[model samples]
Target: MNPLTAKRIAATGSAALKLLMPGLCFVVSSLAAAPVSEVAEQFDRHFEQQLVEHHIPGGVYAVIEGNQIVRVRGVGVRARGGDEPVDPYTVFRIASVSKTFAAGLAAVLAEQGYFSWNDPVVNYVPDFSFRSARYNKALQVEHLLAQTTGVIPNAYDNMIEANVLPDRILPHFRQLDPMCTPGECYGYQNVLFSLIEPIVQQTTQKDYATLMQELIFDPLQMATASVGMEPFMNSANKAMPHVRARGGWYQSTVVPSYYRFAPAAGVNASAMDLSHWVMAQLGHYPEVMPEHLLATITDKRVRTVRDLRRGHWRQFIRDAHYALGWRVYQFGDEELVYHGGWVRGFRADVAYSRDRQVGLVILLNAESNIVSELSTYFWSKVFDAIHIAEAEQFSELHSTEDD
Candidate 1:
């Protein structure tokens, strides 16, 4: 909230991060012990012995269970050419991972009766209008969060990239044709998705950033998480994003372009902060993120077969769908709620399984496809370990009957 406090939070980067429990904590059935957990065994070797040795800049990853952060470690420096090592608490812009927080905030407000999901968007921001008067009246708070506005995907996002304000971009929507009737299908959006900002701000009579802080971050104890560019740029122990050029990673300055859409791409957080976020999604904190709220936000709404075909995610994903702000991926019979984010020089992936009570968050300061590969490989191991343990348990039970 304040400059001094933000710096104090950043100062926490120096705290010694420890491996509390690679302690065979992986969950199998209630009656079963897991096949010796191997998901994190080569994690350090992959990052320290491999990624760092390669030309990439920096990143941080944390493994968290529903009730505790299992292990968190940062592998590289905060900036490409600087000596400030990235620790678990080093703040990085999470990009579109901010959408989860936005949707969570909206759900928080909705539960408080500040506004209803079915409420028309025009009630909050009367200035916003669509080409069709019928569609304008039909668009509701839930439609934007669910990505079913029937607007073209990423509508006017290029204007945001060119440093245009959303107010300027809002009027242009009046000129476009609908892709589908409201709530009929899925079409992703950045500028359009953020219409929730005006809705939340107006209904509660609070700024969007302040509401997110009061409702979500504070309740979840995400101390190092902050919204907007000022806190991110002012924080001393923040990760500077990198762009690959001239055969090496180079430090890149944070641009205000995406920050203009705070609800869409402007939240900054540390791995320490986001570990708590992932844990909350696993339903650890009921007061802040209750089961009802979780169910509302992550309830499968629209098919997203395309996301299942992402680079490393394609083969294993049996099905995929979009919820409020999350993606529900069917991994065999288990469900994984997940999202990934990217901007100029950053990439982030957050995912968790409610059934298993395990979650992982990965943040990278440089743009690299390696993050995708690494995330895919880790989750694959976790799923594999679960299956093998179940098979072994079945075999043991069958043998016991024979004996």
Candidate 2:
């Protein structure tokens, strides 16, 4: 083996090798089994190579299989030209992945009779109004989570990026025209989507952050997960945001203002925390991610403009649609729940297969399109492994019957 590969194997220890080597043997066995450790190692090597090739400053990733965290690894330094190494506990802005948390909280509240999905926004926020009376009247609680409010995509994201307060951005909607009737078309919104926070606060009589902590974070035991910018900035183990320039990657000095629009784009978490979140999504923690609630949130509500065929993994994706705070893709005969986020110089992507109970979450402290490519590559590996495992199991079953 190459020196680097030998060193890595040694550093990971005999346990990882024991798990991985046997798993490789299963791949060649009559009953092929793709163990979690083997799949995780493949992703680890791929991610490491990508980080070097793309000059990424820092990245943290987690893989979950069969409702268990299989791997958590970090590559590169926390900041460009710095010595701090990132790890599983290295905090990062999850950006719009916060929307998933918002949707979950809302779904939980709905289960408790706090509000119906179809409840009009006006009922929760009396002051809420759209420029078009038709849309204003038709808007429902679900529209915000579904990204079907008919507002222009990323409307006022620039303002949020400019460090404007979310309270000031809400009034701008009154001057904007709706592209379509509510729930009729997909029009992604950041500022408008965050309205869920106020609605939750009004109904639950608790702050949005507190509601998230009590309902989701605490139950999942996501110790490093936190809302808003303060906690993230104050974290000693957090990755510093970086931007690429002509010379090399440089640290960003801009304050993360997206936390002001907490429900839409503000969330900070480590790979370890997100691994538990992924497990919950896969129905491991039903007490928190109840079956009915998961069904409601993941239901395909509207078609998005995403064209899966343009990517290299086009042959794997059959169709794509928008669910509550997630993008649902038809992969073979199963559903792939996915979401990607970007804020300042940070980026994140998360996806899972409910049927297979396999998922991945990746957090990066650098700005690049590589995050999307990485997700596609990771999903391809997962699906390929599942296909092999299933085919081998079928062959084994038939042979046993014949014997």
In terms of lDDT, the best-performing candidate is 2
Scored by CA lDDT, what does every candidate get?
A: 0.80, 0.80
Tens digits of per-residue lDDT for model 2, 58-129: 998999986778888899889888999999999899888999999999999989998888999988877777
RMSD of each: 10.5, 9.5
lDDT score for candidate 1 against the true structure: 0.80
C-alpha positional error of residue 245 in candidate 2 after TM-score superposition, expressed in Å: 1.5
**Could you tell me how far off, in angstroms, the CA of residue 63 lies in candidate 2 after the best superposition?**
1.0
Worst 10 residues of 2 by lDDT: 17-26
Off by over 4 Å in 2: 1-33, 307-315, 385-403
Q: What is the TM-score of each candidate against the true structure?
A: 0.86, 0.85
